[model samples]
Target: MRHGRSPWMIRLIVLVLRPLLMVVTRRDWQGAANLPEGGFVLAPNHLSHVDPILISHFMVDHGITPRFLAKDTIMRARGVGWVLRKAAQIPVYRSTDGATDSMRAAVQAVRDGEVVTIYPEGTITRDPDVWPMSGKTGAVRVALAAGMPLVPVMQWGPQEILWPYSKRLRLLPRRTIHVRVGDPVDLDDLHGKELTEPLLREATDRLMDALTAMMAEVRGELPSGERIDIHTLAKPRTTYKPKEI
Candidate 1:
């Protein structure tokens, strides 16, 4: 991380903004204690830029300063890159196949006892029909490689804070931002096993499952809504059984 204000300054900023954001959105966070105080992986469903900031700020209360994975091009920008670098954000080269280095960086960060936040779906959701799109397996890889715990976080109200695909900013009245965090996922179960495609897919699916559940709660939607079961969904579809012939 580049030289900047001390950790106290960062904590101070978070201390002030936490209550302000809570008041503005009437937000209430649940399961915040699920956040690990030391190094850990934070995977959240990405809908807007606000998701990262909100997650980071909420985790701050638990004394976790999370770093993000930004696009490499953004890091190429002269001034903005300087600030991002100073803030310790890692840049992944999305345009090329050189993302391995970025992955390595994330693994190292976790190994060094820091919280690394990743938006597994990569870009924000554009389907307009779901809580999240198919998640990338990079998060799983990092967690498994570093042997760190993975925490799934879900965020809501950002889309309303700034409408999707629009330049207009609308902090509409009475918007409530709710965030829910789930317990850390243990990678020990998969320890010493080869991370084949099927295994990685299964693991990423589990990550998204937890995220989806938490997001539904945050959005105040029923948990039974189009449930996503990774193990079941990964299986081939079978013919429906007859009711009573």
Candidate 2:
């Protein structure tokens, strides 16, 4: 991605585009005051393509534009890549051994007073149930490593924009999106510790717990303790065929 101030053209585009987006989507962003003043990870559940945009667009009044830690593949398109680059979004390659570099970049962004948003689930949920799947510890690690607070963000209504398990992108009118930003998670006790898998997982569980609480609040459901166990979430499933053959 290229590095430079967004051209006047892009600024004008945003000026026109954002209002149009608000008008089209009729997004209602709650808990706007909960947004952190500076750089931090806005970790939210990943359900639809519009999740990031919904959260970020509403928070534009908060003074900092939210940047995403998108997988490097999204930049493959010549046109799309150019836009993302100009917008200063960070590219992250999870499969490569150098994924740590992305974390470092996020830390730097925070130090520079820029907000970085990430979906710790890595990708959207593929579970038969819509519950949040086990999230990677990258968000926790980044928070601890950067010595920055982790803000838990819970958003819904984007799912209404596009149906689950469907390839269709629904952009029709009258769909309302809700974004709820929670307070910054204090990880001061966990700061400066050795970055081990267990430590990271523990911190992540704390964050997810907060996220689930926020999600429940947004969805108007009772908060329960049915969290997924991250340790065993990735075990391969085995299938057995009948012996009729």
Candidate 3:
């Protein structure tokens, strides 16, 4: 597989994430080889807004440039959004455009053999304990459609640096981000089957289980048996946030 990362951009990322990481947090990443050179789905739980930087830093350090599906509003943000656009990250809908456009693009990227990173939970986990909650089927759809591997990745300790839905940053003592990558999810059972709602949920739950198990290993505790899907339960009456990647 051809490495699509630019040498100059890689050097720039290292120069940026290296010193900043040294001061902000320590990292423990396992299963680098789990991410193949060829196209694949990277499914990781969302912790803080800064989660991408840490994971992207690790991927670049391992010599792969990942493309993430970002919210359109985020793509229109001030400085960082500009950087995201310039780096060619894909954009998705928040309350505006439909999600079809982004999924089409991501599927194409996977077909072209680019490493596509997706946070299964469209929004950050609402799990009080920060365990991985339920996932939408977008990631699984893309992987199955493209005949690519769906890699399950879990990260702990980023929430310690910055909590969810908060603006506070705790860089005082410096934290260590525990990142684990598991083998490709077993989709062999679902392959060639019709893409029914039940099938999609099964595939998605398989993904969530893989992530939750790895997360349990990292934190040395089991995740909540009852998953918290904030999108469905948060309102339940009026509006439902679009199922997204």
Model 1 Cα shift for residue 17 (angstroms): 5.9
- Residue 93 of model 3 has an lDDT of 76
By lDDT, is 1 or 3 better? 3
Regions of model 2 farther than 4 Å from truth: 1-13, 127-129, 222-245
- How accurate locally, in lDDT, is each candidate? 0.71, 0.70, 0.80
In model 3, state the lDDT of residue 208. 92
| TM-score for each predicted model, relative to the true structure | 0.80, 0.83, 0.88
The best candidate by lDDT is 3
Task: Write candidate 1's Cα lDDT for 1-245 as tens digits.
Answer: 22123255455556677777766676677887777756778898876656676777666656667578898888889997876776678899875777988989999989988888888887666434346766888888888888888888888777776544444555557567677889887566786788787888788888887887777665667444453333334324232221211
Which candidate's TM-score is highest?
3
lDDT for each residue of candidate 2 in 5-57, tens digit (9 for 90 to 100): 44453465468778867676876677767776666777887776666766666
- Look at candidate 3 and tell me the lDDT of residue 190: 85
Candidate number that wins on TM-score, 2 or 3:
3
Q: Candidate 1: where are CA atoms >4 Å away?
A: 1-23, 95-97, 220-245
Collision pairs in model 2: none
